[model samples]
Target: MRVSSSIDSIYQNNVTLAQDLKSFVDTHIISNKYEKWHYISRIKSLESFALKLERGGISSSSTSLDDFFACTIVVENSTQIDKAKDLVNKFCDIKCKRPNSNNFTHKQSSSFEFDDLRLYVTIKDDVTVPNEQIKKIVFEIQIKTFLFHAWTIAVHDLTYKSDEINWGKQRVAYQIRAVLEQAECAIADILNLSKLPQLDKNNKETKALNKILNVFKNHFNKIDLPSDLVRLCSNTSLLLNQFEVKENQLDAFLKAETSAGRGTKMLGLSPYQIVLLGIFYQCEDKLLSVLMGEIKLSIKIVITRELLDFIQPDIRKFILDNSIPGIIVLA
Candidate 1:
C-alpha cells in the first residue's frame, strides 16, 4: 500500500508538471496568431506509465512520467510548420529535432514525424519546490501540419499500438501514407495560390484599402465578409496602385456610388463581389480583365443581377461595351 501511494504521488506531480508546460507553450504559440491551434496530452493513468517503463526501462530520477508527457501543434501548412519550429527553437531548448520525411516505417515517422521538434524544458530554481523533489521534469513537443496530423491519426487507428509485424497491413499503410503526402503537397500549393501576398501594414495604400473595407463592415454588420474583403482589396490595391489610384479618389468614388444608390444594394453582395464591382468601376479594361481571371468562379456568381443593377451607369456601359465574358447580366 505504501509503495502504491508513492507511485500515485509521483504520477500526480508529473501530471501537474505536464499541465504547467502546456500552459507555457500555449501562451507562446497563441500570441503569434499563426500558431494558435495546438493540442496537449499527458499520460494520466499508471497503466500507461507502466507500459512506457516496461518499453524503455526506468531512466529518469523523478519517475518515468516525465518521458510520457507530450504536446502536438498542428499548423495550417508546411510553411507554418517551419515557422513553428523557428518559434519553438527561439524559446524552448530542443533536445532533438526530427524534420519531415515520407517513409512510413522510418523511426521518426511514427509520432514526431514531418518537421517536428522535441523540446526539453527545466523548471526554474526560483520556484518554491525543493530541488530534489521535482528536479528532472521534462516533456516532449511535436509539431506538424494539419494534413500530417490527420494522416498520423488514421495510421495510428489502423495500427492500434501493436508491435506485431503484419506485412500486409504495413504495405497498405505505406501506400496510404504516400497518398497523404501527395495530398499535403497539393493542399500547400492551393493554399499558396489562394493566399494574398502579405501587405505592409504601415503603407499608405494599405491604410486606404483598410478604410474601404471598414466602410463595408460598418454598413453590413457581418463578421465573415471583412476578411474576404481584405483579401480582395489587397489584390485589387496592388493592381490599382500602379495606375496611381490615390486614397482620395477611392473615397470620392465610394461617395459618388453611395449617393447614386449603390451602397444599399451592396449590402446584399458578398464581400468579394463588392470588391470586384469596386475594382470594375475604378480600374481600366486591362486590369479588370486580369482580375476577372483571378477571381474564383464560385465567388463571381455571388454578385447577382440585382446587385449588379446598383453599378454606376458608366461602369455598366463599360461592361456592356467591353462585353466581358463570364460577367453575369440580367435580362
Candidate 2:
C-alpha cells in the first residue's frame, strides 16, 4: 500500500484540481435555479490510485487520471438527463460519451447494472486554474437520476464491494435496482399520462370526481386539491348523484355564494363547506327525512364555523329550523 513520492505529488496536485473544479461547478452548474439538482464529488485516494496503477501495469509517468477528480450530478428524473448534459456542455470540453448499460436490455440474464450518462470532460480553455497543466486532466462527470443514484449508493457496498459473494444479498440488491429502474421509467412518463386517453369517462364515480375537481378549479383557480378534500369529494360524489345535484347546480350555487359575500361579513366558506352546503340547499327535504338512520353514517361531516353567519337570510331559516344533527349545523 506504499505510494512513491512522485505519485504522492501527483495526488496532491489532483486534490488541488478537485477543489478548483468543485468551486467552478458550484458557481456555474449547481447554482442553476431552474432545476433541483444535487452534486457529489470525490478525488481518488492515493492508496486506491496506487493499486489501480500496479494492477493495470501502468506507469505513473504515462497514466492519465480520468477518474482522479470525478463528480456525479443527481437529477430529478431520467427526463432531465439531456438537460443536465446541456448544462455540462456550457462549461466543460467533452472528450467522450458513454451511455448507461441500463438502456440496453440484457438478453443473457436478468440483472441490474450501473446507470450513468458518463461524460469524459476537461475544463474549458478560457477558465483559469491554479496550474495550467491540470486543465488537461480529463475527469468524469456522471449524470444520474435520483433513483439510479440511490440504488448505486445503497447497493454498491453490499454486493459489489463485498469480500465474499452472497447470492441472496446480490439478488435482493438487483431486485431493488430493478424497482428503482422501473420507478425512473415511470417518472419519465408521468407528465404525459394525461395525454394518452380517457379510460375513466364511462365510470360514474370518475365522472363525479371530475365534476368536483372542475368546479373547484373553475371557482378557486386551484389545481392542487388536498387529499382529504378529494376523498370527501369521492365519498360524496355518489350522494350528489343520488340527490340529482348536477355540476351546473354546484356552479350556480358557487356563483351565488361568491356574489352574496363580496361586501359582507363571513365573506367566504371553505371548499369542504361549499360542497356540503350545496348538497344541503338542494336536497334539504330528502336529507331531513333520513337524518336518523344508516344514511347519516354515509355522510362525511366536516365541522366548520356556524352555518348561520354564512347563509343567506332565507337559508338562515333552514339552518334555524333543522337541528339536523351533523348536517348544516353541528352545534
Candidate 1, which segments miss by more than 4 Å at Cα?
1-13, 26-36, 63-66, 99-117, 121-136, 162-165, 188-226, 229-331
Q: What tens digits encode model 1's per-residue C-alpha lDDT throughout 231-296?
A: 767654654454455544655656665675554356776654554566555565544554356532
* Quality of model 2 by C-alpha lDDT: 0.67
For all candidates in order, the CA lDDT equals 0.57, 0.67
Q: Give a tens-digit lDDT track for model 2, residues 1-331.
A: 6798877876775676666666666666667624678888877778877767668633444126777667888889888888888888877899887753445643435656654689988878987666566676777899888888888888888897677989999888878978887887767887675456853134766776777767767766353346566775765565565566775566676676566552112336556566556555556666555454435534545445554455556655655665555554554
Model 2 vs. true fold: TM: 0.63
Error of 2 at 326 (Å): 12
Each model's TM-score? 0.49, 0.63
Among these predictions, the greatest TM-score belongs to 2
